[model samples]
Target: AVTALRLISPSTALRNLGAATGIAGFIVASLILIFYAIVAGWMIAFCLSSVANLLGMSDFAAWLTSFGLWRNILFMLIFITFTIGIISAGVKDGIERWSARLMPALLITLFLLVAYVLTLDGASEGLKVFLLPDFERALSPKLIIAALGAAFFSLSLGVGTMLIYGSYISDDENLPVVGGLVTLVDISIAVLAGFLVLPAMYVALHNGVEIFTPTGALISEDTLIFTVLPELFATMGTAGIVVSFTFFFLMGIAALTSSISMLEVPVAYVIEEHGLKRKTAVSAIGGIIAVASSTILLNFENLFGLVVAFTTRYSQPVLGFMFCIYAGWVWHRDTLLQELRKGNPDVEQGLFWKIWPWYVKLVCPVIILGIFAQSLWG
Candidate 1:
């Protein structure tokens, strides 16, 4: 009874659990943000600059008007449905299990498609554009900032989502190592996506196509893969269908993974606060998102217009600022240190432990606040 009481005490398990939850939430949310932003950004960049020209559109804006918005709305709906369904299945059964299967399939398909694209007439040019970065184009501070934000956001580093997931984890696991591993995986996928799209752009542009804008990447997401890529793939003849399926399938998987994580956040909130059954909460949230997605489909043009209107707006810096505050301010440093050092008795942890108090108390706040200010001003 004494041991149980001690374990369940307000300051021990409950406190640790709360900290862990916050860590998990941060990781998950940031990762989703990072992956989504990178893939979508790369796609936007390519379609706007190169692919549109290949399609022989005299006026890109006119082409966009003809594409309709409902297609995008349908995509958002599918994305939400697939995501919520996975969470509803339970993590072990849904996330890990389904991903284990789908991830392999996605990779295999991507490899096959890449091989085929490599055999195309413009393959050399495609390889050059993607592999050799244009230092001048990529050297901008804005691009660097965007990349960093995309990295942090996609990796789920700063979000409460990671912390929440961490709450469910045992104390013995090393948070830093696990965090690093997830980040690596997230980045690897983003790079792989670049390989996929840049090659396609090279081929499409080889035919005198001018898809992208002069200054930077831009596009209607609805027309992106469906309109743009399809035209490029058509140049591949019968092989295009196979390539198209693989490309869409890969995209679907990425979207699915990110969407599931998003759904998990609200679901976690409901379960922790309302004491509702996890299954019920998942279903309720899923239903709500599904409805929202459907509405988006009903007015696809407005959805696209709105998304584009607010397009360049990035989520990483915003979310990162929130995270720095949560981890550095709302949560106490001593509590965090004790939680961090639970299993590492031999390691010299003084520098980190000692510096963290000030880091969290002063540095993190200043950095995060500065980002917000810069973003507002920039």
Candidate 2:
């Protein structure tokens, strides 16, 4: 009953709507992992390629980074196996333990990479371009939609991921404070990543790599990791090999951490709803997703972008809107206030306690709907 499907009112209509939303969320999470696993696998492959480069295996390293169905399948399986292995150990031993370790490691590596990237010759230029806002493009509908999608995806909102995680939290914890901390951390890492990537791109250009197309737009925005950064690393000699390995290793950690949560959304549903054991549920669900990843890989030219767009752009926002509606209109305010008062007795006096309920009920849904409508029509 802790699942998103069971989080709403007991009324037949509301319950049915909750079920539909939860199921939609599950599908969205699964679809996201399908392409996500492929990209995560690329991170691992790039890590290994760095190792191969260190060992002077030039041909093998190139093959690792090259596009091939078998390569994608092999690495994707490896990444999924790692995910399944962790999830099989259960939440405390698997998800929590690995996340606690991997996240700190990720931050450390990111800081180090950013520090080194800032020392490069063209980094300041990239920083200028990154920090200075272009007011002309600020109001672009495409930009607004893209930013909305990125924020939703980054926070894992509307997909029941936070809902599932929330089910595991202790009643003694302050939900608002925890949510605030999470938002802050997610934003911080995103900014840090921009620091590393944008500056590093300029550094690549400084090294004579083509970072811009003839029209002045960024070249290979989709493949920037595979092309631009690698070229920048190649110019660094021995240090590049180590930096490359660390960078990709950081990326692999990021992918694995995110994949764990995505897998958990469905795994929790199966174990609680269908009475399957954890290991059995993990293996079954993960295997099915692996098959989906393979299907995407085989039809990479067509399915990859389609799945990404469908899940993140369309499905996620709509599902998110439904969640807002549920939290705002269906759930009784008195019960919500009582729940919030669990950890903080004076929660009613707080700004969040005052604003959140109405905001979530009215403003949040309207904004989500408007943004979604704009995405479709504008």
Candidate 3:
């Protein structure tokens, strides 16, 4: 974290490492950001569709689809514009403020939805299915590999997010303590969200809304959430209408937060490294993403699948592996020690300082490399 902050100043972190690695990481991160924006556009699109259901617009989706790909392009454009507006405000007034406010509201809204679902007939049954793990599937090589990838993606590990965030954190803050708390809070939210969504899924199932096909395979995951759930909730009249609106609004906010962070990376690089104004940096990058998203929207089938496969299976894991390796091996040991010990003298004398850097050097890189292998071949 400290290294990233120190590096993210006027110099990009990857650039600080070296040009070849820096350019490679930058390309991967940029491509991922582009794909992410388009995927998130679906959330905004669904929010629109969900709201239409609440407002008694029966033919909204069908009618929208009549325009073919142009319909999706419209939502993507709106999503990109909305994200650019938030991120262009820069970090404190924009990203940090929205995160602080919307995260709590999102939690409260989730809990409220969970409470309503609990009142339904099959809520308990849904909870049971979610809580009970299928050990065989869980232990499968494919699932294990996927879970590892998910862990990296969820935490944004090796993604330079921590490095960027490190630059913003105050000197007096206890890094270890704060990092631990964040992990705990993130885990709690994930579990709570599962409790909320799974029970609602069960309730929908009980109401005879189909989530699975006759062959017992899950149906279109997107169809289940964005389309069916809102449609099901809309049946309950006024209170359900409120819930539908809140649910989609909550989803939109979540997508906004993620988009903000992704857009920030390159924007920050341009602003700091090239000495461009923040607004200029944001507008320039936003145009690039908007154009990239439009191209993907036009070729949604082959291009979309190719982007997803390359980023997830190839680029992300490889970058993550390279990051761990660089932090462990390539970066000077004393520099790393200094970064870790900043603002906390005790850290220098502690077991963490004694053990962690070497562990990161020796252990972490190997593990990440193994995971990269698994992601490809396992």
Q: Whole-model Cα lDDT per candidate? A: 0.57, 0.90, 0.72
Who wins the TM-score comparison?
Answer: 2
lDDT of 3 by residue, 311-356 (tens): 7677777777767666676677777666556667677788777777
Q: TM-score winner between 2 and 3, please give it.
A: 2
Worst 10 residues of 3 by lDDT: 1-10
| TM-score rank order | 2, 3, 1
Model 2 per-residue lDDT tens digits across residues 16-54: 878878888888998999899999999899999999999
* lDDT score for residue 292 of model 3: 90
Model 2 RMSD to the real structure?
A: 1.5
Q: List where candidate 3 sits over 4 angstroms from the true fold.
A: 1-17, 61-67, 222-224, 227-231, 234-240, 349-351
lDDT of 1 by residue, 184-275 (tens): 87777677767677777777777545557776673444356756676786676545545654576666666666556666766776776678
Clash pairs (backbone) in predicted model 3: none
Q: Which stretches of candidate 2 lie over 4 Å from their true place?
A: 1-7, 139-142
Which number leads on lDDT?
A: 2
